[model samples]
Target: MPHDDFQLPEQPRPYVQPPLPPKRHGTGWWIYGFFAAWICLGALISNGWSINFMVITIVVTFVGTPLLGAALFAATKSDRR
Candidate 1:
């Protein structure tokens, strides 16, 4: 191609990168929460809802599950290219 060609532009457009996909950590926790709720309900009922056990169950299931989920999700990130 000749430099004097009319079809050629004096400057080319700069390259731009596409944005990354949104993190899925929130959705994953929702799924885990649903299942954990069912399992916790079953266990609590099986134990006849003792006050001490209920307290422990609520804390571990609601608090621990999300913390563990976040750590796992963060550690194993996916690339949605």
Candidate 2:
């Protein structure tokens, strides 16, 4: 029999950390967007900075650039299989 003042301590469970979440990945589509915006700027310059065309050019630069980038990203993407 063990004395009341002398008892062994219980063993502690080992520390087990949970797994981390997966990282978000991306393809370099904005690189194409920069190229597209540059091309739009060139077009605006060649058109003598017309106001109406300037508006259209800007719309295309912002709106179309993203669309074009997404299209390229989708087209060239390969399956992980």
Candidate 3:
């Protein structure tokens, strides 16, 4: 094949930028702090450190925090619209 035999396409494919993530409402830190405080308060109240209290605190801190944060964020975002 000759060096100049092939012709380049006239139009090149457009470059596409990936979509950006949705902006946070900026309350994440506060929500986390609130949940941490709740856990600490629970510990303080449960001086004897019963198993049930410990389990409750663990569940609330780990599972409840994200659920509460999501609910709060959704509520705030919805209000903005």
Query: CA RMSD for every model?
Result: 7.7, 13.7, 11.7
Task: Output the worst ten-in-a-row residue range by lDDT, candidate 3.
Answer: 16-25
Comparing candidate 1 with candidate 2, which one achieves the higher TM-score?
1
Q: What digit string (tens of lDDT, one per residue) describes model 2 on residues 1-81?
A: 466435544544344222211211335646656766666675766676667666766676778777877786666543321
The runs of at least 3 residues in candidate 3 whose Cα sits more than 4 Å from the true structure, single-residue gaps closed, are 1-25, 48-53
lDDT of 1 by residue, 6-36 (tens): 5566556354223333455445666566656
Give the TM-score of each candidate. Answer: 0.42, 0.41, 0.54
Q: Kindly list the per-residue Cα lDDT of model 3 for residues 1-81, writing each as its tens digit.
A: 554455444445344212212335366576868777977878887775798678878877888788887798888667645
Error of 2 at 12 (Å): 37
The backbone clash count of each candidate, in order, is 0, 0, 0
Off by over 4 Å in 1: 1-38, 41-46, 78-81
Screening candidate 1 with a backbone cut-off below 3 angstroms (N, C-alpha, C), the clashing residue pairs are: none
- lDDT for 78 in candidate 2 is 30
Error of 2 at 63 (Å): 1.2
Instruction: Give the top-scoring candidate (lDDT).
Output: 3
Order of quality (lDDT): 3, 1, 2
For each candidate, the alpha-carbon lDDT, in order, equals 0.61, 0.57, 0.69
